[model samples]
Target: MEALLSQFSFLSSQALQDKNFDPTKIDDLMKFFELEAYNSWAAMETDLKKDVDEAEYTMKEAEDHLESVMDSAMDEFRRFEEELDRTLKDELDGLEQVANNAKKMGSSMENAATIATKKYMEAALVSATTTMKSAWKGLNFNSKKIHPS
Candidate 1:
């Protein structure tokens, strides 16, 4: 919808730019349209004055309407920009939070792995110590029996 309005604004400006008037031709045309007579000058003067008055009124009305349209367009544009800014900011915040959560998850996984490795190493050491003590006791008993006299 905003795109359509912007396109309309562009086309309207283009139309204003393309409206080239030939003042000489226009003046000749206006003169040709004037009536001829003694009171014609007075009548022409009155008619021209009326035309001028009408043109002025029309110009003022058009200017006022254009001003109103421009004000509305400005307000809409400001609102659109603010909305876009807010949307982008929200998306950015969501991404940041996701990144933070991933980091925390990675750290927690690493801590769990370290603890498991430490516990496994401790259990292996205790099993090896027990096996070595049993082997020594068996060796001593065998030596004493063979040496008995």
Candidate 2:
């Protein structure tokens, strides 16, 4: 690069050395400089593209490795989830048997309490519906006004 720049500088100095340099000759010199600049730029751009392609290939290989790791992690997670589900089912069955035994022992008070709790929850839910609707409307209005598109 330094050698090419030095050669270009020498050429420019030689071009300027002529005492009675013709305008047409000067124009030709300018065209030569322009061509050289364009060719140099094209070569640099090609080298940059090659570097970019190599970088992209390296990134793709990394992505493939990441995907393989994620697949292995997912398989381990699935096995863990299956084991957890089996344990939960066994616990649930034991709880169900305990509840049946309690019911057989005439635990009618628990059933009544459960019904009352359900009724209270339903009433609270109904009462909050209008407030929730109004809040949602206000949020939507503010969001639309603040963010156009």
Candidate 3:
């Protein structure tokens, strides 16, 4: 986060430098004009007032320009944030679909296992019944043959 702030600061400084307006040089140039030592003090005062007004206007223009650039940067950042949010939401939705599908497959497998167990139990019961019936018939036939006197 600190790195991001430092980058922003550097960008802002570079933008200001690109304007090419040095306040120290402007002050020095104004001092060279020497309006303070003019013969007519009132005219000098008016000239000074005009210079101050011009400086104020220049400062305001610079501030407005910087504000515009900052606004554009913020708009770009907001767009990136919105896109990131959309991507994350889409990925989360896909993951949820996968999880639901896995759960459905598990349920199907459990139902198949239950059905197989029921079928096996029914087949075992039928086999046991047939074996018992066959044994009883054999015993009765043996007794009849022995008593035929």
Best by lDDT: 2
Clashing pairs in 1: none
lDDT of each: 0.79, 0.83, 0.79
lDDT for each residue of candidate 3 in 1-149, tens digit (9 for 90 to 100): 35445655665576588786455654544454444435357787899999999999999999999999999999999999999999999999999999999999999999999999999999999999999998888776545455456
TM-score per candidate, chains pooled: 0.56, 0.48, 0.53
Candidate 1 on 47-98: residue-level lDDT in tens? 9999999999999999999999999999999999999999999999999999
Report the lDDT of model 2 for residue 21: 50
Candidate 1 regions exceeding 4 Å error are 1-38, 131-149
Write candidate 2's Cα lDDT for 1-149 as tens digits: 46556755766677689666556655665677688889899999999999999999999999999999999999999999999999999999999999898887656777788899999999999889978988888776445455457
Candidate 2: which pairs clash?
none
TM-score winner, 2 or 3: 3
**How many clashes in each structure?**
0, 0, 0
State the local distance difference test value for candidate 1. 0.79
